[model samples]
Target: MSSTANTTYTTFTGWVDPPTDIRPPLTENFTCSVAVIGGGLAGMATALRLAERGVDTVLLESDFCGHGAGSRNAGQLASAPGGDIQLLNLLYRKGMPAIIRLTENAAGHVESMIEKLGIDCDYEAVGNVFAAVSRGQLGRTRRIAKILRRAGAHVEEGTARELGIPHGFLGGMREIKGGIMNPGKLLRGLRSAVLASTVRVFEQSKVVDIVRGNGGVTVETPGGVILAQKVVLATNAYAGEWDITPKRLSSPMWVTEVETEPISPQRLAALGWTSRSGLITQHNIMENYRLTARNTIVFGVRQIERAASYPLPERHPDPAVVADLAKAFARRFPPLADVAIDRTWGGWIGITSTWLPVAGTVGDDVYYSLACNGHGLAQATYVGTLIADRIATGITPDDLRTIWVDEPKFGHAVPMIMGRLGLRAAWTADRFNDMINGSKRHAREGFATAAGGFTAPA
Candidate 1:
């Protein structure tokens, strides 16, 4: 396929665009108490928090604020942790309580922000489901729920029907917190809040380099430079692009999502999706499905594309990958099989080898928080708030200290060639499992086999 066909697969996101109140880019030298680079959720939240405390802060974005992953995500306000909860419990066993606190607080913080700032982003606290597509996956979910609960998360285990989830999934765990929203609207609202603050905001001001001086840092942009006593690197996936940032801070991954044409309310009701809670499958690279305010279903992310190098270039969702997502959607919701996919878009997300969100300082003056995995919508905002508080008071909260690392020790590199092969293998395995234990068959089979033998459903 032509590069244009791939690049412009979906030019615009289906979400309603918020008002564009443009901010001018920096054209001359500027100075501030804290200079925040990148204007996504983390950066904006950090700047807003600092400015609220009367700190001289300047935020610079290559594009408009929230134009990156903040506005490009599935919009699920997840309270439970991302990645593998089981693995996290094993690796950070002692830090489980702190981790759980951070996850739960992240979700709560978003709701608080919405109420405080009066953001009308269609906020809902209906909670989210860790749905299973097969009998084996259902068993996995039960195990995961145990791990999460042990870590002090509020997780309820039940059958898909018992939990009010649609028919396509089997029994799984439901987090007591979290919901869905129009991320575009939420991000725009945050941008507005930040703009209202005393902080200086600039758009289209990409920082090309950073230099550490005697007592402060110098941020070099094309149009000008920013001299500040402290700097917050809220760039997330783009953090690796800067030489000053640790090379393995984040591995950039691209994920795609698609929205469907609005379905009839009656048809939506027929699917038994009454709760309207977002759903995520138990695959290695999970697929997410959620209900939109417009009566449409949005789903995507059966595959991910990893950037080969840093300073990531702008790209679009591949038409072939989007087609695969549509196919997955059809298999999961046969009733909506014929629904036309309205649009498809993708964005870069940061993923660390540890598969855990992290925050720390590179030095006395440079601070960073990144790799929230795919659950950044809430974590990013909360982490930013924590970082801002630490910068202002020089006192780190438990939450901030939990993820704070003095030096980044990255994992071994999974060669791109091997990574692609591993992804293919995983996709193939999921497909094979789907064929053997189809949703209908798994649902009919009732409860899966327990440690002893097949157990009856409750």
Candidate 2:
């Protein structure tokens, strides 16, 4: 919190846009022990960890840091994956212990990094609300909380009355250790720490090809090339991997988030986040949100139609889409429901077929880590740590084989079948669910009742 540190933290790297400023571009080829591609949370974390190991590292990013999903997101620092406990434990049975440890570890990693590097980002570790928007989901969420607690996790249930929200939520679980954040600021802090070390980072550096050899791996780029003993593809949506296998393990996904002008303190207090961690639920296509320091709400939802057909929009959040989402948000928080949304944006992230992060080396020398599924803030920090550990200890990660196992990813054969149709269907379905369920008279098990229909309000 020193003035010097604040000046450095707010040093404003490039453009002072809503997203964090861009770091300088990587213009020339360089040699290092590790080369991290992509400048988001994953890339920065990997580069920082590599530097900590005293390994020469260079990070290449197509755009400036934080411009990607890491900064473009709504800044909710959640600890859990986006699936049910049964599904996660079943698929990652071997890695279950690691997964549990990871949930807690990710929260710790954020705290530790802020302390060690003097990061001034507004990092708060409040609990997250796994809210149940419907009665059926309430039962399901309670079961999930029990399993998580049995597995040594911390999650408890709360009702709408307890949280001071509407009665739509029959009941939901609250993860005390979960939290929210300013993702752009967090990424900025990491980038500063990265710049301070021997680790070199190149912005505007796009890798074109990847070649592995006995000595190390080489990543070819436009202006230059990166030669290193090991390479990590922290790139998510744009994996930048020429190897067909790594490409198959990942697909691009898009999601939208909106931020309103800071709400009044009284209005914020009404939302009932004693610690202000974040809010989410157990619904299959649920919405998780958080209260930022400025009192703006950062809300997000998953995009359907699968990741395979997810098209990268040339623009930010679509106009009508943002307006509808903003309106739905206002309906949820009546006090500031009318608050004008200062910003509306969308981002592309990688989602594996199973919707879990796939991190592990493809071959001996070529290391690939990606498909974060929105847990990049936490998972990327850990994966970066893993990459560094692998490089330092010289260990083959056979134990993590299942976690990174690549199955062929297939998209719909219809040519761009889902551009506006699918988005309208999902966005409308979710918002309509919220609205219809928002009414007490109609709010039974919204998702399971005859009203479980996900159609938007006509």
- Compose the digit string of candidate 1's lDDT tens values, residues 1-458: 11122223544355656346778889999678999998988999999999988899999998889878998899999998888777777888888888888999999999999999999998778889999887678888999888888888998988877888887777688887989999988988899888888989999899999989957899999999989999999999998878888766667888998888779999899887777889999987789999988888878888888888877877778888888887888888877787777777888888776667778987799999887999999999999999999999999988888788888776643323227777788788778777777645645445454344553321
Estimate candidate 1's alpha-carbon lDDT, on a 0 to 1 scale.
0.83
- For model 1, what is the error of residue 306's alpha carbon versus the real structure, in angstroms, after optimal superposition? 0.5
Q: Stretches of candidate 1 above 4 Å error?
A: 1-8, 413-418, 439-458
| Model 2: residue 374 alpha-carbon error in angstroms | 1.4
Global lDDT for candidate 2? 0.64
State the number of backbone clashes in model 1: 0
Best by lDDT: 1
Q: List lDDT for all candidates, in order.
A: 0.83, 0.64
Query: What TM-scores do the predictions have?
Result: 0.93, 0.82
Clash tally, candidates in order: 0, 4
**Candidate 2 weakest ten by summed lDDT:** 1-10
Residue by residue across 305-370, what tens digits does model 2's lDDT show? 344432344445545545555655655554565566666566776655465667766666666677
